[model samples]
Each structure stands twice: as C-alpha cells, then as structure tokens.
Target: MINASGVLRTPRQTLFWRVTNCAGAQDSARIFRVEKYFSPYTPIKSRKSMNKGEFVESLADRLDVSRAQADRALSAVLDIVAEQLAKGEKIAFTGFGSFEVSKRAARTGRNPQTGATIEIAASSVPKFTAGATLKAAVNGK
Candidate 1:
C-alpha cells in the first residue's frame, strides 16, 4: 500500500537480479541484488523545463547527431508543431500523445484577498493527451 504523499507502507512484491552463469574458474555464479518495483499507483515526478539549446544538446547525445543538425531538426519539428496548432489542428504521434488546442470561455473571476471582480478573456491553449502505452508505462503497468 502507498500513501497520497508517495510513501510506501506495504509492498506486494520484490525483485532481485541473479547471476546465471560462470564462464571462468574465478567467476562467481551466485550473486543477488534486490530491486523494488513501484506499484502502478505510484506518482511520477514532473519533468523540468528545457530550453531549445539544452534540448538540442540532449537529443544530439541520444541520437548520435551533430549539435548543429539536432538544433535544426528540433527547431523545424517544433515550428511545424506550432504551425499546426496555430491552424487549430490536432497532432498525434503513436506511442507518445496527442496535442490539440482547447478554447477557454471568457468568465468573471475574483481577485483573492482584494475581492475585486476581474474579466478573464477567452483564449486557445495547447493541451496534451497521453497515448495508452505511454500512460501505462507512467503508471508502471
């Protein structure tokens, strides 16, 4: 069982790594390392914000591409995404998620403490809906 604040009270199962074979006379055949697998209900940490330059460098390292090429590719892809969203279109990537623009209706809101009435303007904002696979992985299913 786990609490709302992410503290585990009881675990249903535990895992361990075991050595299966020994190729040499000096090699040890039996070694175990315990591993705790989080339950499906565990909460995940949110990702930190990354600027374009940092994103490019990370992608370059992961994809084995030059930083310049990664920058260009990343910029182009982001531009395309922004352009599609600007045109009120939804972009879907398999195993990832869907990005779409949602419209918020204008409404009256109050200023806290001051109790002043304020007019909130209607606006369109981008939203993401995670795909099933990604959602499952996040939930540790």
Candidate 2:
C-alpha cells in the first residue's frame, strides 16, 4: 500500500505482480522500480527534486541539442527562474507549470536523528504547481 506521503509499504515482488497483471496500467511500477534502484532516501537540495543527468538528457533529445547545450540552456532557464522568484515575480510556462513565491511561516520542528527541538525560520520560497496538461500527462490521462 502507498501512504499519503507517497511511500510504498509493500514488498517489491507484491507490487510487481499486482501492477503487471492490470490491463493498461500506467507505468507507476516502472517509476517506483527506477526510484528504488537509482536513488536513495536522501534529502534533495531543490524543490523540484529531479535527477540532473536524466533531466539534461531528456531535454537534449526534446530540444534537438547536444547534452552540454541542453545543460547550459536548462541552467540558464533555472537561473532566470530563480531571479524572477527572488524578485517575487510569478513565472508560468504554458504547458508545464507555474512557479510562485510562497511565504513559509516560522515553525518548530524536531531533529529526527537527535530528538532535539529546532526552530525553522520563516522564509520566502519558490513553489511550483504543475499545469493541467503536465498533471494529466503524468497521470496518463
């Protein structure tokens, strides 16, 4: 079973068998398999949490450019995004998503490893909300 937090509690074999038998099932199983094998349960530095190499490669193919060029373009785009967000401007890409600045209120949290209380400072952060097209595509709609 999957939790509200998007964690799968079932064994791999169980998930595999169950997903494989479903007719025309979306490839969530493949995604889970890739995530399981490729990435560890570590904190991601950015909000998007995408794998850089894979993102660059895919962009290269889509944009018909070299990987290096794709990487540069992606970096440039991200830099622009960050700049706009820093200025409290909202950015919207027609088919992809919108990025807006959000204010996170200061809150108290616990350090899981040490069991110590910690204060999380209030801050403005960029948040992304996927467009309907992107969401539908991800959901195989």
Candidate 3:
C-alpha cells in the first residue's frame, strides 16, 4: 500500500529506503520500503538484445577495423554458413557450436479454424547445437 509521502507501506511502517533514479525517471529520489523495491512498485529491466548493426559496431571496435570492414566480415561469415547449410554440410566452431540441416518429415495437421485435416510437406531446416563451452558460458560457470 502507498502512504502519505507516496512511499510504500512496509509491515513495520518505519522502514524506508532512499532510491535514486528508479524507473528511469529524472533522478527523482523517493523513500521506498525494503520490500517495495522488487516488483510492481518498480519495474525490473533485463539486459538488452543486440541486433546485427550493433553487433557490427561492437565487432569493429574490438577488431580495430572500419565499420564497413566489420560488416563485410560478418556478412561473409553468414553467407558461408548459409552456403554450407544449403549443401547439407555441418558447420562447427569448437568452443561455440555446430549448425546442421535437420530433415523434418511431412505430416498431417489440423486446421484450427475449419477443423479440416491438411498435409504438411517435408522440409529441411538449419539447426544449432550448442557446445559444452558455450553452454557453460551461458550458465555462468
């Protein structure tokens, strides 16, 4: 519950924490109860995902190369992977992972809207299998 000064009401009603810049506001400091710092009272933010462009910029910085060069390198790697997968060949990076073509057999499926049966055609798709090193890194080992 919220109290008079817009602070959350703790069980003790005497507990309060000085929070600065909560919810990305303009550094507005507020008194929060110890428990209110976790959820609906204030939203939690996770790490942001990196897109291709951002990855290219980061790569350029790390490799001490021009952005164009980094983009071209990244593009080349992707193109090679696609070419290899097109040939039904596997791509492996020892400490990273492997990519291979997975064959999915045709099957019959139901149409939820019409409740009619349909046949799904067989297809080959690229799949990734993470290696132990990558798995450990992801799991923070």
Candidate 4:
C-alpha cells in the first residue's frame, strides 16, 4: 500500500522482482512485490480468538465424542443459560461463572450530532460474573 504521502510503504520480507511490460511498450521494465508468509502449515491466525468450530472440535477431542455431539452439547448448555436468564433466574456454576440479568435504568441522553435531549428506555441485559476458579485459571495461578 502507498502511504505517508511522500514516503513509500514496503512490508517485511517482501520480495521485489522486475518484469517486462508487453502491453504499454516494447520490453518496458516494471517492478512488482511478492509477499512471503512465515507459516508453512497454516495461514496466519490469531490465537486470542477461538471460533465455534474450533471449540466444538476441542470439546469433541476432550470428551471423546463426535463433533456433532459436542456441538449439540454446547448449544444445549447455551440455550439453558439463556432460558434461565430470560426467566429472571441466576444460573451459577461453582468455580466457573454466574449468569444473570442486569437491570439498566431509564435515563436521559443527549444526541451528539444535534445536541438534542433523548429519552433512553430501561432494559434487562445478560451479564456474566467469572467465579474464583475461572479467574484463577485465567491468571495462570
């Protein structure tokens, strides 16, 4: 990408090759850049985030079950949690987390663009509180 207006941008480990342009002129020299990837097994990915598919696969491996079974188990657990929260009930898994509904109060908010006053309605939102064991595990204790 061209950047900084006056300066040119080049990525790390970028390979530059010169080729002859045939369409515009006879054997006109043109430069091109090729990007190189360090990983040979898989493309670059973030380890911070795990998608549903990966989670299901991991669950299946750990539980010694099929992917479909693991996915169904996960879906059922999520459905139960959501159902409990919707019913105004708190579901607490000891040493893991607690799921509950949070009540938000109605308040007046100002519109940033027009500087106008707006009435914001109150709502119930789902909240999760991590338990001691979960927090400790995250902290690498």
Candidate 5:
C-alpha cells in the first residue's frame, strides 16, 4: 500500500503478494504502480446463514446420503429436541451445546399505540446455551 498525490493506493496484488518492478538501478526504491481493484459486483459475504433447505443439502453432501434421508434425519432430531424440551427435559450435546425450555414470568407491558397497560402471560420458550466446543468453533478455533 502506498499513498501518493493525496490518493490512497493499493498496488496490483493477488491475495498473498504484490508485484513491483525495481528500475535498472538496484539502489533505487522500487516504483510500483499502485492500482487497486475494487469490483462493485464482487460479492461481500456478510454472513453465512444456512436455511433449512441449505442445511439439509449440506448434510446430504457431507453424509453422502439422499436429500430425503438428510431431511428426515434433521426432522427427527428437531422433533426429539422439541419433545424433550416440552417435557421440561434438557438435552445436552457434549462440547456442542444444551437445549432447554426457559420460562418467562408474566408481566405488564405498555402498548405503544394506545399507551395502555397490557398483561403479558407467562410462557415457555426454547433456549440454547453454547458449549465450550461450540463457542470455540464460532470464535474460529
């Protein structure tokens, strides 16, 4: 990277290295034409979110199994987790995470539109706590 003529410049470079030519004189500092390539169309991957279908596809590809089989397996796993959670049972996957039901106490909330107080009923919601391995994986370990 070089700044010249009040312009921020990036030398033409590949992912790992850049190309620069030193003039005939070895003593001279290399004068490299700094040209940055910025493509507006280059896709910026903000996040890799896997939907249910994409997840099934990934599972199928990884397991070398049919899509239907993968889908069924995913469905079964989800169903079992839901069943266990509904029964107030916690499911823990060693080093992965734990899934359980969290209960929210009933409360009163103000309605924004009417400025009126409303009663919010208590409810149970599914919750997941990431385990050590899962946290490590997310942190790029």
Candidate 6:
C-alpha cells in the first residue's frame, strides 16, 4: 500500500527501510516493501546461475587481472576441454571434477505430440562428474 508520503508500506513491518537514488528519481528517500513470506515466484538463493560475462568479470576481479585476460583464459580452458572430449579422453582436476564424453545408444521413443513412435539415434555427449571437493563446496561444507 502507498502511504501518505508516497512510500510503499507493508502491514507486517511498522518501520520501513528507506532507499535513496531509486530509478534516477530526485525525490526524498522512498520505502520499497518486501514480502513477508516466500512464494514460488521468489528466487532461490542457493541455485542462482551466473552468466558467462558476469563469471568472467568476477574471475578477473578476484585474480587481479584484466577482463580481456580472464576471457582468454576461460576460452582456452573451454577449448582444451572440448578438444579432449572430442578425442574420447577424460579431463580431470583432482579436487574439482572430471569431464568426459559418453555414448548414447540408439533407441525407440514415443512422440509426445502425436503419440507416435520415434527413433533416437546414437550419439556422444560431454558429461561432467563433480569431485568430492566440489560436492562439499556446493553443500556448504
């Protein structure tokens, strides 16, 4: 609800947080309300996915390197992984994970739209199995 001062008010909290410089507005501090409960639409904190650019920027900042260098390093790592996987070789980083190519056999499958049978051709795809350290890190251990 909008209060008399044009600030959003939430029924659960009598005191609201004041935020300035919102959306380039030059008015006084405004209050933005937050939900008291979580809904399905609310974002999950544990599984937020970072985009490639953001990841690269963060890596650069952490390593004290330029973004260009970080980008090149990231690309080289990905290229090497792709090359190894293409050769049916596995790439392993002891505490991180391993990446390899796996084969899928051709099989008959059903078409969901028309309820018809379909054939799935055999192919090879890259797969990654996380190592113990990575698993522990993800689980907040």
TM-score for each model: 0.61, 0.55, 0.67, 0.66, 0.67, 0.68
Which has the greatest TM-score? 6
Tens digit of lDDT per residue, candidate 1, span 1-68?
54454445533332223334444444454544443444555432432456778789889989999999
Tens digits of per-residue lDDT, candidate 2, 83-135, equal 99999999999989999999999999999999999999999988999999999
Ten-residue segment with the worst summed lDDT in candidate 1? 10-19
| lDDT (Cα, 0-100) at 124 in candidate 4 | 100
Question: Which candidate, 1 or 2, has the higher lDDT?
Answer: 1
Best prediction by lDDT: 3
* Residue-pair clashes, model 5: 0
For model 6, the run of ten residues with the poorest summed lDDT: 10-19
TM-score of candidate 3 versus the correct structure, residues matched by position: 0.67
lDDT by residue (28-132, candidate 6, tens digit) is: 656444443223443345445778998899999899999999999999999998998999999999989999999999999999999999999999999999999
**Candidate 4 lDDT tens digits, 1-141:** 534332332432222333334556544455433343333333333345779998999999899999999999999999999889999999999999999999999999999999999999999999999999999998889
The alpha-carbon lDDT assigned to residue 13 of candidate 1 equals 31
Worst 10-residue lDDT window, candidate 4: 6-15
Cα lDDT tens digits, model 3, 26-49, are: 534553334433234332234256
List pairs with backbone clashes in candidate 1.
none
- What is the per-residue lDDT of model 5 for residues 10-95, given as tens digits with 9 covering 90 to 100? 33322222345655636466566434434444343533565899899989989999999999999999999989998999999999
Summing lDDT over every window of 10 consecutive residues in candidate 3, give the lowest-scoring window.
Answer: 38-47
